[model samples]
Target chain A: MAHADMDTQRLDLPEPMPQPRFQAGFITPYAFIFPALLVMLGGLLYPVFMAMYLSLYDWQIGLDLEDAPFVGLTNFSRMLTDPQVWEVLWVTMRFGFWTITIEMTLGVALALLLEKPIRGASVFRTIFILPLMVSPVVVGLIWRYLFDARVGWINYYLGAWFGIEPQIWLGDAQLAFFAIVFTDIWQWTPFIFIIVIAGLQALPSEVVEASTIDGANWWQQVFLVKLPMIKSILVIALLMRLIDVFRGMEVMLIMTGGGPGRSTELLSLHIYNRAFETQQLGYASAISVLLIVIVFAISTLILTMANPMKSRSDV
Target chain B: MTGLFKKGVGALAALTMSTTLAFANPYEKYEGTTIVVSWPALSHFIKAEELIEEFTEETGIEVEVDALQYLKLRDRQLLEMSKDEGEYDVVSWVVMWKGEYVSKGLLTPLSQFYTNGSLVDPNYDINDIADAYLQNGGIVGGHKGYMPGKSGAMYGVPFGAETSILAYRKDIFEEQGLEVPETYDELRDVMAKLHAAGIPALTSRGKTGHQVTAGWLLHLAPLGGKIFDDNWNPVINSPEAVEAAQVMREVVKTGPAGIPTFGFGEAAAAFLQGEAAMHLDTLKIAAMSRDPKLSKIDGKVGYALHPVGSRCGSETGGFAAGIPANSQNKEAAFLFLQYITSKAGDQRMVELGGDPVRISTLQNNTEGFDEYPVVAEQLPCADPDWRPLIPEWNELNIDVLGQALTQVITTDDPIQPIMDAANEKARAIMEREGYYVWQ
Candidate 1:
């Protein structure tokens, strides 16, 4: 009886049920989509599958793929066993953690602090988001030049004011990692800040008023009311940052070239070196497959944490 | 609201897809079609574009040249080629990609083009190109895989190749009354004198890993040492190599501040800007001297063989180009390949402030720079093949030389400790990489 009722309701809807909105292409629906879909299938899907296939072979970039003897699971096994891969992964995770944590906390806190319509607040907000607007590569180059041991502005100030020796920002292993993290935070915190402000602006005001009515103090209102309401938006901001962290090779590659030792090598940079510089295509592909898996798992975890019921409305 | 959010995400991804797929057809009646030629971001390529109008007039192919530094360019080209898109018909590359690309059937084998005599001018002889330059930039593996086209074959083409030559300020030598140092002892003597004069003799080492590593190896090579032996075994700890290291460590006392973090750009800049009086660099800088825009030294540059430590030799480094085997327009690619690497192209490049590898271009009596003394004097012995012709050299470089050279300049650590660490690490890398290890 329930099913029949649902079917009757469906029939009562608009004629042809709006022709299945966003349908795949050809003739009835835009035929242009067919060409576009085929392109995606060929360009995106094929590379993905080929990457998986290549992971089974001992492939080199300049060597014949046919000559690459198939060694199923060995490439994956090698990647798993390699200490350097793990080292890079751990460094990347730590990097991601530090940047994301600092950016998110400071970003959200600053957004909340600046939400008041104070004098010159608009100017401060504009300037805060400006860093986000600059291209990441340009930001990297600017920072790299500023941090140069000999000619950098940072060292100049440090030397002139503090009587400190000019530090090798990108030449020391630990320093390079910190330098990249610092650069990333400097450029990207604004992204988190802007998103948080937007989230704050759209939030309903009645809840805060109601919390006040319940005798909640400022901290109480923020912790017990506003934060819960914005929890979902926070997840979205986290998702974007996590993705950027995984794939941001440009700044790191340009700034440090994954050097002073492999100390600053993020997974993406490592994959780049393996695929091109070292010419180990199969190994790089395998590494990327694992990366995709890791990213997917993390996203899933974050999504689940954000939405307990897996409900779309939570985000 | 839910539908809107999903649509927005879908639309953004779709937008990214459309742009990437939107490669302009090069043969589109010579109108809006744009062909992207990927290359190293070195100013040399940009310098050549000043003459691109001539190419456009002759061929009617609208060109949009894009460049990135070579390492990133290599990464981008590899990733892009693996997709098998016909987006770029021509891309700048080094010889390393030839073996892999040819075997994977991703690079065009230039043999057929040469056999037919249709792609290249018939007057071009196979021997016109120096054998050393061709071998260094030729096919990587023991396969007839890819040709860079201009050197009488077409899988790829030479893009203004030049060997690494030691560079120093002529005025420095004259002021100090030092003859251009050719041997290690002479270089040491010069360094000792400069140290006594307190002008910071050697350019900083360990600035950028590759920059420091590259020059240092060339410095060490003339000492009759190499990072690896013929079997790809790591033998950098040879007595000659150690002696080379010891001298480098001592010479580095005269290195500039922050020596650990300097790159070729800084090192060369220091030399050219008259900050560092002596620098071992490349012959391509010869173009820099005569050009008013690039020259920091006005009539103050002098050149010689990279100082010989034990006298094996200096190294060669330059750019090469390859046509993907799976390119949709193979014939068009070959034609562009030949055009770019042709004697005319090379000569024009030199005219446009580029370094030329071809003797014919160097010997071009018509060009204005031929009157410059360095151009005439240095062209004869500018041989390449100083860097070994091995596909594995790139790895050997990053693992072996890249690591050690950084240490050689940074710490006051003994040369023996650093060389030992490098040798041990290098051997394991070679063995693990499936090379013939000297047990």
Candidate 2:
């Protein structure tokens, strides 16, 4: 009898209202998006296409594009065996690994520690993000001076406090690499903090309440519920940082100039040195193409692990 | 009385007309034309900037100066010159680029302008410029398309030609009873003595790339090392070259606390601050050493010709002014070029803290030529081929030899192996660039 009553109630409900439809023809939506599509094509796609085209020629810096010899795949073949190319790539990978690993760990740890409402919480958050506000070039200069062997405050303080001897920070190969890695981490850790904190704060309240009611401990709740929910955000932050690591090198360029014999020369800096320092534009373009491929592959792999485009249940 | 007054008025009017005709501005025809100049932000160019207003007032041609950092100046000029319509009417280039610019046809030959009497001032004596600066900066189109030669076409006018000189502390030398070193062995002994007496003996540029290569070249030529032979083969691994590298390594040992990372500015500062006893680099350092505001030991600095090794060869390199081939205001640009490099302009350039390229200016400018004696003595020894002027030189200098030098100075590695490695890479690049085609 209850089932029959439920069925009769469903049947008696008012007919569903018809969905609204656009009165204009199909051209309306296309017209609305045309400007954005044009921007993407011109601003984003054009340079990438030009790089690909130029990579096929043996073009030097001063020559006209028409006069450039059409040496198909010669630049690419050269890149495959160029020892400097491999060395810089190896350096970039090592740099990316250390910086990203530490940044992710520290960023998440700090976010979780300060995610709650507390005394001066906003002030702490602002202070934590200050390094992100500084320009990379300015950061490089500041760190370079601080790391100077003779006049730097770092040497001064070490001597004053502990009587440690002053070291040539940028002159040594290992130290230069360490200095650059430390600088990158100092500048970029805040980005991950911002993203991860936002994701942590946006979790639905009821789920946490249910978990608490089930007698979950703080550690259990964080590990099993909060972290699982914010996995996608963490992946995205990691991907962004990885991309930045490959693209940005101004700090290293200004600090060490990829020196102490290219110990800190990342792939981007290598491409820059090859392009401007050596005046081999076509060879540099080939290296850039390789960089773009590597970045694209890494992004694709990360996105597959945590697809943000998936529906909520799927996520 | 009326007739006498009329005759006086007629005479005065005729005198006024003749004076006005005699003093007419030669550049008045190009009035209202605005030409842009691209220059490096070196001390010389910035000092020369003070005279731009004077140039404009005289020529009635407005001038816009684009003073860029030394490293960025070439990139900016290359970009401008590559365009069909260039923005820079006048451009300044360093010695290393003279070959590339002329070979690429980016510069207009000054010979044509000089021969065309209408474009050149009749009083402009091209021969008055020093042969070292003129041959290095002006001549191109020889061996490998850019080597300095007498038979080559004249492309640019030398403006800031510089040669290296050895600077030492007069007071310190007198206190120690030291004689000015004239040879490499003497230099080493004197430097070791100074170092043992608790004074850093030398300050020089070693901060990789061109900085390191430039200082090494100071020793390279004097120590009997040449980058290449007559056949364009890299001889950097030769016995004399290895000796040069070893000598540089020893010099770095007795240099300032952080000598390996010092650029020109830092090296200059070390000497000015009295942290070091000697500097063997550009003659411009002499001017800086005498500036009371810049130096702590201003009148205490002494100048000498570069120390001799197997032979005496001083560095000859600096800037030159050129007109871009695509410049829209070629005549105006040439006029600007001529005005700044003339006898009076060269003197004024020295007064305003710029290096002089003219022989007469160095001799005649008593008020500004403080280092005139030593520089004049050093001029004849200036070697135009101090470093190779080929386009491939950038790679050889920066990527191979420069990086190898950075390695050599920073590490205690075997010098021969590092130089040999650099030699192999240089050979490879030259082979690829067709420098070995004759072989």
Candidate 3:
């Protein structure tokens, strides 16, 4: 009887007033986002615009900016034929290819193998990511010392264990390239591993369990179901790593200084040397513009193909 | 409220007047002002910092030293000067940058400062500085703009002077019954003997760009190889240069296994650790080699003039401190420069493992001079233009010439072709910079 009386009182109450619609005017949403927009404009767009403008001028170090002569598109035209630019680009591609491939393969394999909760898993994870925590310059210095022919532990151990002669790891072109690649793998593979492991742990237990019960082995389940399910995550991780390759240069700069003959110079480092070392600020800016376009185009292609947002929508 | 405000204003005025009265001297006028100095992380800078307290105590001024890597310091100065921010009151510059800095009007002319009796110390004898360092490093474009001596405006004061010298193990030379090498051919023979005696013969800088280029210039200049002739034509591919290149390649075979990648630090380490019998490098390393804490051959190292090829001289390179034109405290900065490069300051620097620019310091019959007598002996034989004084020299020498040297050392390719290609590129760069009008 009490429940009936409460229901009658609720029905007798006036129908709830219609909820107010969000009155987002044209300026209100922008007002809320103005701070973020301002930050992006200052930090990102301003530099891009400045680089584009500077690329058109023939400026050099120690000269006042106003004294710089305006040369329309000459820097770009020169860059088109610059053999050094092409050589560095080729090196960047080759380095990225080897490092990314090895990192992805090793990262994913390790993640799968260690996906199960095991003793000391946290400790192993900490050790794996320690390289990523180190400063790039410090990493370069450590590796430089390690690769020293006269005093390096690497040469010492190699000689002691395998009876191999001491090698000049940074002096030779092929070896220097290998050294930088191996260093990148050491530092970044853990990033991929961490990401893949997160994705693996987040997988629905019911589907994986059902796959296991359906007579699918571990490798089969990972390849046919689990990996396919986390395809978008893999794509995002790959794109982020690809961007890192173009942006990264401090390690190479400190280790090889882009050379035993431009052997280890990435495009970014070449731009730096041109600007500071050669004092060709305008030419460096022109090269920087090229680097930006290349990176932007590649990023756009990856995002368009993978379309992580589309995958979310499908889910 | 008005009575209190009147009392406050009166007290402030009285305090200001008393402060002004206390600092009546011109040098003390800049009292309480703090000046910033940007310099390379060299031992000289440490010595300067240690002695700066004396300046502060005398003038009632304070100084902050920003020690940075050599390259970083150069870039910072360029950036700061270009922006006209007055971030650095004093800038320490390499000799190679004198032409560039002066041409850009980045450094102030010190003639007026020298004339100002209050700013210039009476006992700070400008003539006491070595003539070679004064003329080559302190003066630019015939302007005695830095450490002026009866000539054009002085632009900088020579603080550290380095001339290339040959350092070898004295015991090893005696054991092999060899005298100091007097010529390139003799050097080759000595090296051969050392190698056969089962000792690493020589170590030199082979890292690409500046290190290799600087090392090669030490060889090239003494061999009569010129970067350009009077006609401004690139002549780095000359037969003399090729011979120097060949000698460099041959010499490395007897050096440490990674001589091709060795920089000055590595080469110096190899020599100081007694792993190599000889090292051809700047005299600055000679100072370090004599430090017992840092060297295994501290007492056994012998210094000699660089081996002569077709010519009989060595390359001179070092750092100098200059007042940037954009500095707000130009007078105070000039005082600081004079203090550090002064006779007493240079002696103190010598004691602290820095190369000396003062003749008195070099001539002093002290233990420091006795240990490195060859430094003073070689100063007279330094070739000022061995590295050239053009603004574009760093680029041409490192990118073109150094790149060529790197290729020759790293690969089995013939030296002539690589040198010719480098010359072609160098000529193009020079032409583009409007440095040459003749084809």
Model 2 chain B lDDT-worst window of ten: B142-151
Instruction: Order the candidates by lDDT, highest first.
Output: 2, 3, 1
User: What is each predicted model's overall lDDT from 0 to 1?
Assistant: 0.70, 0.87, 0.84
Residue lDDT tens for model 3, B133-190? 8767778765222222455566888776677889889999998899999899999999
> Which DockQ value does candidate 2 get?
0.55
**Better DockQ candidate (1, 3):** 3
Question: What would the per-residue lDDT of candidate 1 be over residues A1-315, giving only the tens digit for each residue?
Answer: 999999999988877645765565536555757889999999978988988998999887544588788889988998998877898899889999999999999898888888778899899999998888898789879988888866789889999999989787877777778898899888888888888888777877887788889999988977777777777778888998998888889888778777766777899988988887777888899999998888889999898767634433644
Interface DockQ of each model: 0.18, 0.55, 0.46
lDDT of 3: 0.84
Candidate 3 A-chain TM-score: 0.91
Candidate 1 iRMSD in angstroms:
3.4
What tens-digit string does per-residue lDDT give for candidate 1 at B1-439?
9999999999999998766544433332333335667787786788878656676667666676777877677666766676646566677776555554544556666777776643556655545554445655654544222222343334555675556565777787788888888788888888888878877676645644455666666566677776656556666788877877766666566755555556666666566666666766666666666657656786777667666665535554576776675555556666666666677777777767776656666666433553234433443443343444455666667756776766776566777877888888777766776665445
- Among residues 3 or more apart in sequence or in different chains, the pairs in candidate 2 whose N, CA or C atoms overlap within 3 Å are none
* CAPRI grade, predicted model 1: incorrect
Which candidate gets the maximum DockQ versus the true structure? Answer: 2
